[model samples]
Target: MTGRFVLQNVKTINGIAVDIILENGKIIEIVPPGTGIGDKIIDYKQKVFVSSGWIDLHVHAFPELDPYGDDVDEIGYKTGVTTVIDAGSTGADQISDLVSSYKNSKTNVFAFLNISRIGLKRIDELSDTSWLDEKELKKAISQYGDFIVGLKARISKSVVGPNGIEPLKIARKFSADTGLPLMVHIGSGPPDIREVLNLLEQQDIITHYLNGKANNLFDEKGEPLPEFNKAIERGVHLDVGHGTASFSFPTAEVAKKRDIRFNTISTDIYRGNRLNGPVYSMANVLTKFLYLGYPLKEVIDAVTVNAAVWLRKPELGRISVGDIGNLTLFSIEDESTLLQDSEGEKRMAEKRVVVKGVVINGEFNEC
Candidate 1:
């Protein structure tokens, strides 16, 4: 049966309170606190905040694939995130397996079909250009276009091997053919980042934008690089893919201080990072951004409306009448908290972002 619920006085990061009513997996109505009508309801009483359902754009949760991957629920509904897009965890050849498995999951799962046919079955999926079979790619995308929301290419020294920029260039051609928004993973670069950034047009996403490495957005003196700024000005989007080795606290802090904002905030959550150090969940990554000085509304927007806009999936993010009833109920707790980045640098913040409950497919679940 479709579950129904009413929540009142759910607090926000900005101290505003909202009341929501969810029915049949869509938001039926939104009214002021204590104004909604329903039974079997929980009067939150101004203790939590409600935002659109959270979307994790970059995660590796194809459990049967690799050790780097994790369970969907561990990084999805269990952590208050309603939607998770497995970033290049599978290629065209294996998407059917993933989609079939995820159909039974409670979390809303999506995928970014990797440029390489084998996906991340090996860390060096892009090492051989032979695996980037254009014919097979088009076939897979055509067959599973619904599940493959976008395409991904990891153009880094380790992943791309001797192919350098050739893999990305090939992926670009495939993106042009399929007309999917390409998500480029920037890491220690063998191919110059300037070339990579220049090739990206508007709507293309650069994940892991704040890596502390010299090859990333920050300059040697910690200033935002001119090339990076130009890329941003060209309407390219920046996403925080806080993976096991990607995020750097100092880099994020410097970017935040200069008002270099992210278009979307995503945790590249998986088994290793989720259970070990660095990224524990999507909330943990969002809290790190909070520590980096992003305002409450901005943080909410990044995961909600902003992400939906970038993904071109208007139905996924937002709380409004007739929209998918995906809502994240959370709180801003004032307390001392210690947060760490991938680099092991630590900082203390007085406020933490906490999850109370989430409204998913019109059903309420505790976080």
Candidate 2:
């Protein structure tokens, strides 16, 4: 794993063939196929499509919590995702432990620190007002400035309990004080979807925006709610945090027909969903988007450049020379694949996106 290496004869998502040369964990050159030489060559022979490494913005990678936890690497590089954002699986009380736990993993990890100090220790983290300790949250963010990307507040009825919109008010204050955006999870709501959307400002994220819950962003006739449109106009980002009960094919199809789209695609992956039914892997989720009629490039961009731009880390999204060499090697096969949504609806896709390997920090690992 030393010296220089060349990933030879790989096609970009747009179908241009190139040879990428890597040295010292950085991309050194990108040239036409057959024009690059290196100490070691791992040739894909133009069969593989390469893009900037995949990044999943929402995942439960804590690995200790029941039902909602998983090992970081298990859902990371092993599945062609070089980076994963643990979406509020930990808060101030356990943020340090979550950081330490992923130190040796091959996948790059970041987190959306839960506004509740207790985090997902209980499913109803924001149920108790005492758990929303601003002092402790500030301390955690100060300690892990680089690791904590934004604040996460699950504004659903079950998560917020009797608190209603109170927790989100506190989260808004925290976001203002901490200078970080919010990644709010929306679902069954008594605070009302409009109340939650109104509280979010520019650059904040609304994960699981396409869920088919009774309190979803669309109306009975599948039209986008006015609040949803306003939020988008305000620059609030939409993320497809397709979890066990979030994604709905009908909802997604309507969104596509209506021209509403995702800013990023993520799997709210955990032990239960990853192993048993929906939300299997990043690739599976991407395939679902492809089946929804999104072009291959758009589907891949949702997990790559679009996500990277939202995170403000452009290096993680493009295959340019001089950037760190992190890329996903996959192929779209001309075969029928069964795609299932969280609501148990199914669609047979004519093509499936399959991961072959990844170049992580200039080193190759097969998926």
For every model shown, what is its TM-score relative to the native structure?
0.96, 0.98
Model 1 segments more than 4 A misplaced? 12-14
TM-score of 1: 0.96
Q: What lDDT does each candidate get?
A: 0.85, 0.93
lDDT (Cα, 0-100) at 106 in candidate 1? 87
User: Candidate 2 on 1-367: residue-level lDDT in tens?
Assistant: 5479888999998999999999998999999898899999888889999999999999999988897899998999999999999999999999999999998898989999999998999999999999999999999999999999999999999999999999999999999999999999999988899999999899999999889899999988889989989999999999999999999999999999999989999999998998997888998999999888899889999999999998899999999989988899999888999989999999999998899999887778888
RMSD of each: 1.5, 0.9
In terms of lDDT, the poorest run of 10 residues in model 2 is 1-10
lDDT of 1 by residue, 1-367 (tens): 2566788778655677767777777778778788877765788888888887899889998998667788898888878999999999989788888888787788988889999999988989999988999898889888888788889999899999888899988988988998998999998878888878878878899999988876887777777778888888989999999998889988887888888889999999889889986899888888887887777888888988888887788878766799877878888889888989988989998888888888777778888
After TM-score superposition, the amount by which residue 66's alpha carbon in candidate 1 deviates from its true location, in angstroms, is 2.6
